[model samples]
Target chain A: MNTKPKILIVDDKPENLKALRKVLKDLDIELVEATSGNDALKATLCHDFVLALLDIQMPGMDGYELAGILREEEKTAHLPFIFISAVYTDNLNVFKGYENGAFSFITKPFQPEILINKVKFFIDKHQQEVALYELNEELKNANKELDAFTYSVSHDLRAPLRAVNGYAEMLNEDYGTHLDDEGKRLIENINYYAKKMGALIDDLLAFSRLGRKEIQVSEIDMNEMVEGVLIEMNKSITHNAKIKIGKLHQVNADYGLLHQVMFNLISNAIKYSSKKEHPIIEISSNEKNGKIVFSIKDNGAGFNMKYADKLFGVFQRLHSQEEFEGTGVGLAIVQRVISKHKGNVWAEGNINEGATFNFSLT
Target chain B: MDYEVEILIVEDNMSDAEMTIRALKKNNLTNKLLHLKDGAEALDFIFARENYSDRKIENIPKVILLDLKMPKVNGIQVLQELKSDERTKKIPVVILTSSKEDPDIQECYCLGANSYVVKPVQFEMFVKVVSELGLYWMILNQPPK
Candidate 1:
């Protein structure tokens, strides 16, 4: 493995190339010699050079012309160049060298230390960029692998849970008359826990799936969406919360994902405020600072403001399962869906006080 | 083997197959139901090859309840084989699987699956879905003469 950095040295004269090589020999680098501009182009095709040293007094093509040609080609467009010139030593010539995309210019009677310093700078920079690119690729692969693992694990978990639930149901159906009261209760507990685990797995799968789902954006009427969500919630939940919905503004978002966000927020509000004497749930939306902001406020059992940051985390519940029945994945899913749309979610509440959940879409 | 088969269930999982049979039995639809353990046996049974060579190919089941994830050739392959062959293409194939997370559902429909149903984890829901499926396919749906 050739781990050494590569440098392309383009000079018509052999002694000039040798002098440049002698200066850079102390640094661990592989020097590729190119006697002409065309040869230098060919070297670029074979090797990824970190930096190029061009001599201005070449026969057919000057250093400035070579740098300009390299800039024209996409392969070597960003390849940094150091122009070494004896004849074109004037201020205008230096400016012309820069206009042709030269990083540094040196006269014939130059110190080797100055040239070495400039070359080292570019080499270090190129190495850093390569390292960063590799790190990014690795992170992407790890994320994809995690999603696949979560998906398959959650999927495989359901089969066993189904069996547990199925067998328990079978036991209850076939032996209900023979079993004692405690025995039947034990069977019911088994069934209940099995169903709960199934729900948790389902929620985990849905959350993991959000990472890979491509967001399809469409205009959604907030009023109509809220109405539909309320009707759906009414089918599953029985609550006496006096729900008041204000006029909402239409926004562009993925219809399905946004529906989930609304569903989770409203359901949480209803669930939390069900203990209130006169439970009141208010839903409203407005355009603020060039973004649409929606808020759902509920006069129910709210949480302390101290643990507010942990509210949106996956399976991070502030309350116990006894106080509130949740797998703690709803808010996490809501956060993911909103973030996927380039939106932000937040809340404000105190212990035993009302809470307001807000989300903004740009 | 000689009796006419109305519903053919191709599932590798024994518990799931038993539960499905139980569900079908509730609706009185299991009189002619036949359960195969894997996709290879299912292919052999449907095409009347290998171990099933003695069985006639003309005895097509009214509906096939196929599971997506199975050993020795999955449901997509089974669905493709059944849909492509003219003799077995008319038999309705309903997909019953544990997960809807994969793109197999779209591919199943694209390959001419009669219906795609995800098996619920809850026992009561599973029984309801499976029994309804049996009543719909066997009693209500009319198969070709």
Candidate 2:
């Protein structure tokens, strides 16, 4: 449990301080007492307070004068203060109290219940503000740590991987003539696995970059974008596959990210369905609830609907490496990019029937 | 060989330096390639100062393949010093590093790097990249008189 909130009570007379302390004794608070304005300022120097109650008729420096001083310093500028006085109850004095950043005013011989309610309000508000400030600081530190981690992933991790791959390739090139068939095959396996690792690293880095890169939003023609991605990824699509692209609507999104989403989905459609003699992949879109729902359907080795929920996760794949080759980061990246545009990604499929990947832009 | 340096590679890691040199050698660029262990040595060789005073500054290499993270002085610092100096500013400096971090790329370009290439993790790709870059810099690119 949190400690009781601190309250500073300042008055010149011993009886006035004693009376204020006695009334507040019932409430859960740690109260500090001061006999003068100077003493109160010194007390503030050593401790933080949730509420400060000051008497208006103190010697040398009065309550309003002390509040003015607190307002000038950044440390105590926002400190909640309540001015108490018997003689200074006029309209001019009360207005002066507010001008010096007084939160509330309590006259001498004020009601015990009224003072308690006002004190409680300020204490709760101060605690809430402090908690919020701490939470904001934590979020900032987390973002900084992520940036550092990504930098290391890009540089430090890849360096050793390059060394491993490079040396293995060198060993194969230099000693292939002397090695037996089995020896050569083992080296080839090393090379293959190393290359796969390199691709995975590249995919992970690209995914991390999407989180940091600022999105540039603009109008994009989905049909034109798909046509362009198909041209770029022509080799990935098999010669026997038939691709049908239906009417696609224009959308407001980040052009580069939308292109990636299409690339990953279309390539996935072609790859999964490539085993069939006549592969059929259809791309279509429709408007629903003032948002565009784009879908890709392929007649290939479809996954079970039971694991559909895991389709968009990073490195999450339903198919084994023997059936299909992938780093499993494509769908994860697609999800992240679409979500960044205030959109959603989901899939539906059955065993050996086919799969349809759908996404919406809001 | 007329003591002319065609390609100056500044790399700190021993394995990377050897592989980079071997890649260039495979492309038949073995004759005039000079490999320095760190940025400080590269700077000294370029300015022909300290222990390198016997060498002529006017005979600067056609290209400098500089790695970013190094001891004594980093790649960005070397690029900055070279670009700011009138005597050595004309030589092309390629940033060959494992880091594809945005800030490093932006800073290297701002410091007057001629080209930036991330070191590929696959050995075959690394060899291909190094050989292509070597041929392009040593044979294709023209330096000022």
Candidate 3:
């Protein structure tokens, strides 16, 4: 809904205002006339004008002071200025105009085309700058809204989820044997579904939070990180699985986001290996070019490599909800964390044999 | 005004209210219970004396169990009025809602709710919460005189 560009004519003379308005009447523009410098300052307070045409030799708090005040206000700091004076002044006045953040100085008894061209130039530039500023503000506001949503999910939303999980557990505990088998199964399913819903909400919140969170770039130890991930994995690793580690190296990245990448990769390795006999999982890190490259290998039931591109999409799970239990947010979280830290994550796997997931931080 | 009831459940869902009552009954705290189906009815009970001069309104419930997204007068409005009034100011109100929106929680607390609780989707966990709430508020907490 952007309208016509605005041009403010600051002068005590009504005829000059009307005449300038007449000259620029053919173009898409708005001409606002302020009789005195004080009036101009007051006018600028409300309306947004693209170019301010100031009469330099007018009354108290003249052109220069008005420009200075406009510059001081963050709201109007970048509003373009042009000094329109009908004075037979010297080069010194011209020099003074430039010093006061004036874009151009048009002399008295100026040609109509010259005034029109000069005013249009600053107006166009100002319009572009204003548009950019508005866009930036919109982006900031959207990010803030997302952040608030995440905060709500993490704190407020957890209440009902807790209630669901808590109450479901109570039902089974209090009257378990009294309830029929179907009823018991229903209650268990209810608990299972509630917990799964809670997990989804949490992962979504984390994904949204990653958008605004700052990334601290530094050298992170891949060896220590892999070990830490392995330690966390050990608790959940119930099967006879073997993890083979290759020579690891250091890489520049945000430690938290990088840790998230490895954590997800290793967890997925463990998750898909439930059916395999003596599941073989291998971890390796190496320096490729100037960037750090890392991979996780698993001898498990793998997905079709053709659909590998779809793996990192949000809520995209390769297997059915019944076959593999997941929120379908793990790899998506991994991809996002990697991307936020200026990295990329991808995988290559064929059914039955194995899969290799690798990423690079640039 | 002096309220003798220990738990005041303000809820619109009949099934949920029944489930909640069953949980409370299991813990043996159903005798002093007062259940209202809607926010408007709850408000009427709280400010009951205004309509019926002969029937005196009790001071306030020992603890008010509030549901946020109810018909007519919402839970937030109820909280605001209760907190603002000197007579009902001391009564602890807990917000129970399906919505986990931060704004709902903030608005509830901002209007002076004592605690916020979200309803679980699972019926069993909901029963457990009901049982814990019974044990906690009825047995553990010392209601204001």
Candidate 4:
């Protein structure tokens, strides 16, 4: 039923065709034999074959003419062929066989094992190529689905969240004095939680966007980027945090993406250590193994080492939302941005001992 | 005499429109502000066509606050029509919506949007934003003759 592997062998002599058939009879393969080049071309149209064995010397239509015909047809253009001939085994003829797309050639007194091994190699290669093509099609479909998901998250989800926050604020601003203390507190909680959900949605959108966004690499000044981020953070974080900036080196990266990485790391450091009378955060960089490694060490609420692997995962939190106000997507975004830059990121921490986050770029 | 409509807010969400109007009222700017439900109504109001034929076409609003995603028509289409027409091209347009997608931002400006503001999730911040926008577009910015 055409399920079995097929091979075509063509020759002008009956004895030669018999020998070729006898050699391949042991294998579970269908063998089609042709006595002339025209007959070989006709046989190829009827059955799909893994390999073709062609005789260089033939009657009206020779092996080269048959191979050229098969190559012209779109269906058999990539069909593998091996030339077998007793008369045209000279250098010029053999070179012509190769130029016509013969994968390998077998002479009249060729070894049986040599013919079998060459056929097997082409069969395996064709199978691998088919599998790779299927995999690529699947990847393209998956990316299309991901794009749709990111759009829904960015537009559909945020629209309702904005309404919830907006109306609640309106209620509180217009009717706060009319309500009792408990009523006022309840409205405040509602607004706070709504804003929290909005923050989570924003983080999710950012994380998904990194999947499709292109990264533009440039030379970034580490010192200037860190200074700017710290200044921005200070406006929101009113803690007695003592930040120390060590000797930092310039890096080759996407400026905006790497800037987000620095912002996330330094913000985490400051947040986890806000309880201390004087929160100490240190930033440093060094050259290692032809790559620049930067580290941010903070004396804050550290985590257990057992869950270290979950640190970079989306929505993975080492501390409760109450202890640290974050959507847990900070580290996940940091990891994704660094990985897109072809870099590595990891962290080390211990409970109540503070945590150190490190990333490297080459 | 033709009525002067200083601010035109094109928003589909009722609560958002109410909140925006309240913020403008807090600054005593709601006296001449007009809120339409969607881009279609806003277009009708500005061009003095269909239901708005009684309104004078010369009395254009000082600024248009457009939202991107709407039911009948959208902000981009409205902006395109406004910027292409000679009578309405000189009026300023501000795109205010929840979408922060980069493509939307680029497209809005390409369609002649004067400014783009992503709505903040915090109510207090939203109130502050609306008030500032009203002040800037209604009082500060000058329109073409």
Q: Candidate 3 regions off by >4 Å?
A: A1-3, A9-25, A32-43, A53-69, A82-309, A330-362, B1-4, B50-62, B83-92, B101-114
TM-score of chain A of each: 0.79, 0.65, 0.63, 0.69
**Per-prediction RMSD in angstroms?**
3.6, 6.5, 6.9, 5.9
Please, what are the lDDT tens digits per residue for candidate 4 over residues A248-333? 99988999989999999999998999987778999999999999999999998888999999999999998887787788999999
Steric clash pairs (candidate 2): none
TM-score of each candidate structure, all chains considered together: 0.86, 0.74, 0.64, 0.76
lDDT of 1 by residue, A280-361 (tens): 9999988889998999999889989989999999999998889989999999999999998999999999888889999999
| Shift of residue A143 alpha carbon in model 3, Å | 9.9
Model 3 per-residue lDDT tens digits across residues B1-145: 3345668899876656767888789889888888888887777777764433343455566778888877798888888877898777888888877766677888888889888987765666676787887788777888777
Q: Please list the residue runs of candidate 1 whose C-alpha ends up more than 4 Å from where it truly belongs after superposition.
A: A55-74, A84-109, A179-183, A215-259, A278-299, A337-348, A356-362
Q: Write model 2 residue lDDT over A243-321, tens digit each, in one string.
A: 9999899999999999999999999998999898889999999999999999999999999988988998989999889
The candidate that wins on DockQ is: 1
Which candidate number maximizes lDDT? 1
Show the colliding residue pairs in model 4. Answer: none
**Chain B TM-score for all candidates, comma-separated:** 0.96, 0.96, 0.89, 0.95
Q: List the residue pairs that clash in candidate 1.
A: none
C-alpha lDDT values of all predictions: 0.92, 0.89, 0.80, 0.87
User: Lowest lDDT 10-mer window, candidate 2 chain B?
Assistant: B1-10
**Model 3, A261-323: lDDT tens per residue?**
888888888878867888988998777787777899999889998899899998998898777
